[model samples]
Target: MHSIPKHMPTSTVVSASRGRSAQEDPWWVRWTLISLSVLVLSVLVILPIANVFYHAFSNGVAAYWNNLTGDRETLHAIQLTLFVVPIAVCANVIFGVAAAWAITRFRFPGRTILTTMIDLPFAISPVVAGLMFVLLFGAKGYFGPWLQQHNIQILNAWPAIALVTTFVTLPFVARELIPVMEAIGSEEEIAAISLGANGWQMFWRVTIPNIKWGLLYGVILCNARAMGEFGAVYVVCGRVIGKTETMPIRVNTLFEGGTSETYSSSFAVASLLTMLSLVTLFIKIALEHKTQADLKEAAQTHQTE
Candidate 1:
């Protein structure tokens, strides 16, 4: 130590230099990271939101409010949207829970194929989704004759419109629930049965509690997707103005006609959608917390018993 080497070994110098290089990220690297983050915000988020709010408020808040309140068509659209969103979401909720049960709880033949079939909508074109109904319920569709003969009136009808929208969104609830269900497994179900719980009781008490968050989150997604549905609904709906036109269809019509006022009113309507999305976001957060708390509580209760 007293006679420390006059010159530090070459290896020591190189090692110290490498450490310094690791500690100090290059300016280019930092700049690239910052640029990417800013670009993501600029393109994906900021632009669309800017466009919506800009058009919505272009005529000032007073005009927006007046349009929302006085326009019968707009008012009807909002009402119809509220009416359809819940139905579609609820349909997805029951079906999704059922699908999750079949896929996770029981082993069935063609299960993988069925799972893929369930996800088919995600891959198919929305226009195709709409066209499918057109083929099925349109004047020349496979079932069109029978349906028309029965006076079904699915084409250009709200129920028809709602069905198409529901079809497109059915996957939402299922996709959300499946993963969470896989994570949960049948342990709790088996546990419940071990304690003398019957099938109905086990599902109502154990299964529902465990997957409630998944269901809630899926509902939020389904509702949002359904409310904003355009593709399949438009094809089947005939955009029958006061009867079957959804908010998105209205925006397209207004934009095509170059009606600034109508377009702006449409955005105000879209702002209603935005409000729903925000509410969904909040609900998702709340469900996450509730699920975590429930799991922790169950764990503590289990330990004590």
Candidate 2:
């Protein structure tokens, strides 16, 4: 012991040597790599966002303010986006929790097929997604006659927009939840049951807390997609000036030729979408950190137990 063991492990020596080698890299090389990464990020992401802001205010703050405040269509577009985002997010949350719980908590035939079906939206184009709904609800659609009899409006309406948006963004939450639920396992639920917790109690107290971060991550992604949805919403919306147009559609409309719309108006609306994306990024990063911390805490707790 006093001699610190003459036969020290070779593995330890090798690891120390590797660590030293890694730490010995020149400071200039490290800085060069970091600077390169930052430069690339600035070009790919920052530059475009800067361009949007520049164009949005090119005519000055008064024009930008008027584009937002004086435009009824723009206001409706914002309202429509706000409406769809919450509803779509809520629906996806319910579907995600149910689907994830069903898949992870139970074993049954066709489970794989069911999961593949859930991911079909991701595989298909958003335009195709809109087309599917159109076929189901259009005037000549399968339920078209029934819907007509019932005086139901789906195509070129808010209903169609919501439905198509839902279809396109359906996979996010369930996809996020499946892996998390699998890793956490059923042991906690079993234990909670043994301790006299009911189904709802066990889920609310044990499962929800563990999966909340992943769920939040999924919801954020879903919300972003729902709000930014263009192809599907555009297809089904019929671009009704103020009734069914969302922020994306509004931005697109603003740039159409033969219209009185200016580049500033279009870019101004676009900046809103860009800002939403930035906000989503911020939330996602924060949630990722929180998720990592929770995972570490859970691991430590499990080890202690």
Candidate 3:
């Protein structure tokens, strides 16, 4: 048995003294929460981004414009980022899709071990990832001397940068697509096969359409990571100024070099990246909404039928 206090509710008694409400979450609490959130955001994300934009655009609109369109080295760095992002993302996309399919469709020895291995990069430091390639491909590395004798140069080259980026970003696409694939199940695929659909047709019609959102989500995330990869690229590519410098590597060099002229360009690149990330975020949201809407329409159609 329980007893309600005399001052408390029989059927929600109203308190007329001191204006205290029955609910604990008052307007003051809400405002307090909003204020706290604004404070933290102002310190963390907003401030940093504002600083970048301020530096990027501070020297007037024309200077920001010139930061991008005027500098050849900066232009080259941007091109390198563009080139590496696609290659790294595509490699990861293929491997990730395959890995997801393997995990969902088959039972095999060391499957759990392999899945854990996929998450290794997430746990380990990026500096260690660079060291891994360095140990494998550096001048006196395990096979480095042997290869170098024959004029082979995997390290300090674009291939090394691309490979390292691909390896590091590999887990992103698979991580995104795996749960979606597991939830969707292979029943539709089996059904497509039973109805005499070919492999390509079944995949295109049944497999891709369902998981397209997840795939896109993974690709966007991976591209973001690949574009900004620095430690590994620095180690492997040797930061050869205009040649091997991606956006991040270029920014670090500019920061190190004290190039005031390049600071705005760095911020411009950063802002460009931020814009791409926002676009990716929107795509993910739109796809998720569309997927939900499609599911609802399907349920309605079935119910009506």
Q: In model 3, which runs have C-alpha deviations exceeding 4 angstroms?
A: 1-24, 291-305
lDDT of 2 at 86: 86
User: Residue 199 deviation, candidate 1, in Å?
Assistant: 1.5
Candidates 2 and 3 compared by TM-score, better number? 2
Clashing pairs in 3: none
What TM-scores do the predictions have? 0.83, 0.88, 0.84
Q: Which stretches in model 2 have alpha-carbon errors above 4 Å? A: 1-36, 257-261, 299-305
Output the lDDT of residue 247, model 2: 93
Q: Number of the top candidate by lDDT?
A: 2
What are the clash counts of all predictions, listed in order? 0, 0, 0
Query: Which is the leading candidate under TM-score?
Result: 2
What is the lDDT, from 0 to 100, of the residue 236 in candidate 3?
Answer: 85
Q: RMSD in Å for candidate 3, one decimal?
A: 6.2
- lDDT score of model 3? 0.81
lDDT of each residue in 11-59, candidate 2, tens digit only:
7876897888955668899899999999999999899999999998888
RMSD of each: 7.7, 4.1, 6.2
Tens digits of per-residue lDDT, candidate 1, 225-268, equal: 88888888778878767767787776666566566677677788
Q: What lDDT would each prediction earn against the true structure?
A: 0.81, 0.89, 0.81
